[model samples]
Target: MAVTFVLAFGGSVLAQEQWVEFSSPRDGFRITFPGTPGIEDVTWTSQMGYALPARVFTVDRGREHYSVTVADYRGIEKLGIAKSQSCAPGAETCIGGQTRIVGPGYWKSDVHGAITYAVFMLLRRHGTPTGMTWNWAEQVEGTLLQFTNADQSRTSASIYMHDNRLYVIEGDVPKGTPEPELFKMSIGFIRPDGSGSNIYSHRFRISAACAAATLSASDRAPASRRPPGRVSGARTFPASPITFRSMARLPTAARFSRTTGRCQSCGGAGSSR
Candidate 1:
């Protein structure tokens, strides 16, 4: 029998780290790890007795274990895919349960409920979480949840839904490991077809620039000033909306970082909430 041991988080001590590239053609992701990772296929059984198939890639370095799990929801029904809402202009919120586009193609989803399901799954498998917090990243609009197990192992996970698949990138490290943030940011999706777009980032950048311009052109007194994005002058924006390349071509690193929440070298923000 294989011996099982709890890799205590408190005992993790850093040594010299060697970074390597690990790519998953089956799951469509590529990430940098301290060493070559081992792969395994795992089954996640839901509370309702449904089993979801998942592929996990894990690497163990000094005091940390870097892992990425890609879960397929093609036939699973527990976490239903989210449908786009067509809301009225004056309505506060729209009705849900519209027919969800179900297929192998990935769709952008609201990740709040999916994150909740993930938490439940974690609880079912590993007992109660010692601590938890929510986080968001630009472009993909994912939810990063941090958890500590009773075994003193710390798990920092970010869940993202793309193309009808759920991607969970997790780092389990000892409590005092340095640069945990960088470990979390090392995960990235590898496009098989090389065709993808960050629609949310594009919209956010355009709106942010428009809001800044409106604020700069505001004429009202401080006390009576209206909110930004309500400029009164004639302003012309591009008929063709901004693209990710344009966002990349922004003047400086700091300015681009502000828009996309990513560092120039690493390609994204490192910290989770």
Candidate 2:
């Protein structure tokens, strides 16, 4: 939920766009948002008249050895497979950062092979002439296991994403490549003070992730300015718009004080009118 806001507001969301490779930060090792591998390091330019995608939220770690990220693309959701595979995740398991089975589903992409497992998105191994691409959101809880068969693999790098951001967390686990092992989670952040932080350093990994949000009118603003998809994952949402109002745009000043029942949406996540 928090990450959703970061992307929508930080400048990534738009009417619907394509992926753009980020520049700068020189060069560094890339991990699958291992914490939440997704696309980042973007920038927003004012030359477009309106806010455009511009910033580097997609994080890479390890100091210039590799690159991993999460990318947003198109996909499909199937149901019958859930019956055959039988890994329906319940409410208790939805919390961020824990290990649970999602569905016996998979993410099939032309880039990577069929990364089958128990989750919503698939982490395809789509390597290009320059680098590799793996798309999936970061796991809040329940590790997302990506198993291989034997040794003799071609690529030495990878990436992943969850919610809406990508992460770089996994390393070349040569020892347990084929076996069913838990996927490693990580924590990366852009703090309120405009600083960067990776919550999941080499010492720790995320278990179950939880992000709270205010999901009301959203479309009126730039998509990125909103938040990540709903945490609850409701397929259907009310068709409304979230508008950004400027004080100067108002015809007259309608002033009031906090003590006199002023601002309407002023409280945090829990309070209400």
Candidate 3:
């Protein structure tokens, strides 16, 4: 139910609210504000054909997200690559065309969803308590960009920057693009006009509520063993399971931190027990 945003921030300032290039793996990504550092790198992989994505949030000391594999459109819905124009497909026109906002469920604290596969999601703030529609069917450079929109119908920006001027590319979230998979069930299908277009995937990732990360034991370890024939150092965690109980209810040992005068906030008033 929590939607997290993964905004790109590597580019030269263009005009007012745009930039000339973008932060990308192939293109080299970087975001240097007083905020968090850039991610050292992102390594995504699939398990049993399902995705088990993991990445570090170098931007903030303690932040992370998950991702999955989804499809792209054109002709065949499975491979995810557009086949041709004669075969108008998912999220084609309706997604690219201007539409009226209609859905009204963003009033909640967290929101996440997908376009076609109905699972990719973002934070609740990205939507309106009411929904909207879109009409973004425009052609640029021979590659028809099926404009994407939310229930609010706000057109999606290319999310990339290029040249002295900002550029917006339209299409499926570009194959292999990383996205959270937590909300892959709340989105609805909308091919109001079969010819317009639709977008969906077998699976997509959605960000969850940002919580103070409890140090997972694996975080302390470096990359574990990898699969046969796969590149080394992809940094996947072992699929071990463990549980934690609140220290309050169970009688526990007392400890102290020389730096902070607190016991990890387990006490009633967060003072010495």
**Which candidate ranks first by lDDT, i.e. highest?**
1
Pick the TM-score winner. Answer: 1
- Provide the clashing-pair count of each candidate structure: 3, 73, 59
For each candidate in turn, the TM-score is 0.49, 0.24, 0.18
48-95, model 3: which lDDT tens digit per residue? 121222233222111221122222211112212122223345543322
Rank order by lDDT, top first? Answer: 1, 2, 3
RMSD of 3: 24.1
**How far out, in Å, is residue 147 in model 1?**
3.0
Candidates sorted by TM-score, descending order? 1, 2, 3
Please list the C-alpha lDDT of all candidates, in the order they appear: 0.49, 0.28, 0.22
Tell me model 1's lDDT, rounded to 2 decimals.
0.49
Looking at model 3, how many pairs of residues clash?
Answer: 59
Instruction: Show model 2 residue runs off by greater than 4 Å.
Output: 1-67, 72-143, 152-163, 176-183, 192-273
Clashes of 2: 73
